[model samples]
Target: MLKIDTVFYNKLLKNFKINIKYAKIKTIHKVIIGRKGKK
Candidate 1:
């Protein structure tokens, strides 16, 4: 149904956004820590 599809799509988009935000934060953390140091 259309409603179900919409809900699924919204969930997917929310997950994608979260993933992107996490990736960005991780990259920033790595940059701040430098390559030689342990995470």
Candidate 2:
């Protein structure tokens, strides 16, 4: 019921946070690679 919903919501939130972190890391890597390619 309510408890289960909270657990599910928490899991989703955690996953969303992890995804955002990974996306940020990926963008940073892309920027570094682009700079390396220029030289």
Candidate 3:
């Protein structure tokens, strides 16, 4: 049971990290598009 919990925790952390990366990229893309619109 302990081992299973640990594995689940690791997967959750990995998914969280990936989500953060994707969010950052999305924000950056929005910023770029905003700048182009301003021009």
Instruction: Please state the error at residue 39 of candidate 1 in Å.
Output: 16
Off by over 4 Å in 3: none
What lDDT tens digits, residue by residue, belong to model 3 across residues 1-39?
999999999999999999999999999999999999999
- Which of the predicted structures, 1 or 2, would earn the higher TM-score when compared with the native? 2
Root-mean-square deviation of candidate 1: 3.3
Against the true structure, candidate 1 reaches a TM-score of: 0.86
Error of 2 at 39 (Å): 1.1
What lDDT does the true structure give each of the candidates? 0.94, 1.00, 1.00
TM-scores for every predicted model:
0.86, 0.97, 0.96
Score residue 5 of candidate 2 by CA lDDT.
Answer: 100
Task: Give candidate 1 misplaced runs (Cα > 4 Å).
Answer: 35-39
Q: List the residue pairs that clash in candidate 2.
A: none
- Name every residue pair that clashes in candidate 3: none
lDDT of 2 by residue, 1-39 (tens): 999999999999999999999999999999999999999
**Best TM-score among the predictions, by candidate number:** 2
Q: What global local distance difference test value does model 3 have?
A: 1.00
Query: How close to the true structure is residue 26 of candidate 1, measured as C-alpha lDDT?
Result: 97
Better of 1 and 3 by lDDT: 3
